[model samples]
Target: MSAAAFIRITRPHNAVVAGLTALIGYLIATGTLTPPSLLLAVIVALITAGGNVINDVCDVDIDRINRPDRPIPAGEISLGGARAYAAALFIAGIAIAALTPPLCLAIAVINSSILVAYAVRLKRIPVLGNGAVAYLTASVFLFGGAFAGIEGLVRNLSLAAITFLATIARELLKDAEDVDGDAAGGARTLPMIVGVQRTGIFAFACACGAVVVSLLPSGDWWGLLYLAGIAVVDLVILFGAFRGLRCTTPGCVRESGATSILRMGMFAALAVFAIAAVI
Candidate 1:
């Protein structure tokens, strides 16, 4: 396969999201050089990459309408080829996870199940589909801790829950941005059902709530600093939402800059948490 075909099949930009998930796991594990930690990160990355491929395969038609320049839609790659690529990535991920630890393997299975569900059925449903994606995204960190044999399941659980809610909010805002494409494809997203304005409001509330929760845990000044920074990012996101509401343009909503800021904030927060954990 050519380099162009590879890029088309892998969707490198989405791969960064997957890598971030694995990075969260690695940071929590805090064992950067350890074999188990490295293996765990690899597993998570492969699984996430596979999931992305599957998502594109599942959304080929929608993408054709929404993103005609995409590989499958643009005829740079065939649907069959995409499915094969996804299968390869999924198998590789599972193999890596199984080699890591029991907990990591179990989480990998669960993650894969959820991704399949999303591609097959859940993605068609409003709100529920987005929730599954968000929840899975948060699971990467918990999976990391598990790999480290940290008996912090409860904390990880709490983090996962909060992350899930936060991700849902982001997903909703994203839906608002893609309203036209989703609507054209008959996708029943939150924004499609509730209207973009209402969805934006809901997302802002979720973002605020996440910021508050991040700051709730005491013991660590670094974590607090991270949370404070995140709060500022949340404020910017809120501003974007309000602007989108006023503009009512897909471009405005989609390009709101909230997603990037939130991602950066989450990474910073995780880094601070890792530092606090060490100290």
Candidate 2:
């Protein structure tokens, strides 16, 4: 297998972004950066990479239809190789976490377990699967904040909540996009159960919740810069969510671009949070 295939299988870009989120979390918690913050970023990145790899392994069949170009489906990597890579990454992440604090170690262990579970079984469920991914995304903040103790964790809670809602909305929309592949794989995703139209509405509702929660940290504490940036972020998210309303059928939703728009909003929000933390 090519080295690029291994990297692609891990979805390294997504892992790096998740790493940045953990760094932002630490920055927000302590208002300063430390070696530990960098360590947490690496740990999160490694674990996220591992999770992505394992997910690819578990999703080989689905990927054949939904993502034919993926490493596994494209024959760039074998299932055995992907599984070993995942285990290595997870072990490395947990080992690094052990160097921090007990809290960090605990979160590392728990998140790793959840990631495996999500790939192996949870992803076949409906809303539960969406919720699992949402929680894992939000937990990066918690993992970063663990460096500063309970106070740090508490400070990051609002951010975690906003992220959780937005992630769930995106996950639901993604389910709609993958309905055919998921159905063929015998998976019971939300859109498969309630229809794409209803799933779109649920996604919209979750997006609204995310927008509301995102505003909670504005004003003097986060500064007007954050307020202004978050306003734009919320608008983009809401607009993306509004577009979901037009997706009446599975075929329509698959090509709607609503999910991609929502993902842009998320990346925008991440940038805003990082900039605010630094300034």
Candidate 3:
């Protein structure tokens, strides 16, 4: 495969962001950086890259319609090549995690397995698929916090909660965007079963839920900086969700850029948490 094809299939931007988010979690929980913390970040990035590659491998058919420009559907990379690359990344991540604490190793194994499962089967199961992806995204923080012990986990719980809810909202909107491709691929996603309008409502509710959670005691405990920063991020997320809700068709939702907006909001929230913890 070409270098660009490898990068495209791996989605290096997202992998890098996931690694940075984990580093932020480590910083928040420990208030100090260490060599092992860097290792954790690397491992998370590798696993995330693996997950993206594997997802593309499994979604080739769906992507052919919804995202024909993607690496696989565009014929930039072969399926066998993508699968081998994904396996290598996953193995590398798990091998590195094995050198860390036992908890981290456990998390790495479980998360890798879940990523594979999500690609192979869970993604066709509607709400369960959304929940799985949400948990996986939120768990990156938890994985970083694992290095610091139970107190670290407790400290990062609110961050995880906000991430989880927002991810659900984004995932649902993505399902809406991919409704046509998913239906053609014989997948019964939420947007297909419950209808696009109701799915949009569900996504809106999840975004609102994330916003509410950002105001809870756990969030306040981080002080006004966090709350203030999150307030701006939450507004963006809410606006995205509102736009999603107003769209009854996949084409409209895609044109609205609801998923992209929510993704940016989530990345901003991670930055907010990092900034609040540092300051």
**Tens-digit lDDT track of model 2 for 64-159:** 987999999999998898899999999999999999889889999999999999999998778988999999988998888788888888777767
Q: How far is candidate 3 from the true structure (C-alpha RMSD, Å)?
A: 2.8
Task: Show model 1 residue runs off by greater than 4 Å.
Answer: 1-4, 29-33, 66-68, 74-76, 150-155, 218-257
* Candidate 3 positional error at 51, Å: 2.0
Q: Global lDDT of each model? A: 0.70, 0.86, 0.88
What C-alpha lDDT, on a 0 to 100 scale, does residue 149 get in candidate 3? Answer: 78
lDDT of 1 by residue, 85-189 (tens): 888888888887877668778888988889878998998889888889888878887887687665534345545655766777778877888889777767788
User: Quick one: best TM-score, which candidate?
Assistant: 2
lDDT of 1 at 222: 35
Ranking by lDDT: 3, 2, 1
Query: What clash pairs does model 2 have?
Result: none
TM values, all candidates = 0.81, 0.88, 0.86
Q: lDDT score, residue 64, model 3?
A: 91
Select the stronger candidate by TM-score from 1 and 2. 2
TM-score attained by model 2:
0.88
Winner by lDDT: 3
Candidate 3: residue 87 Cα off by (Å):
2.8
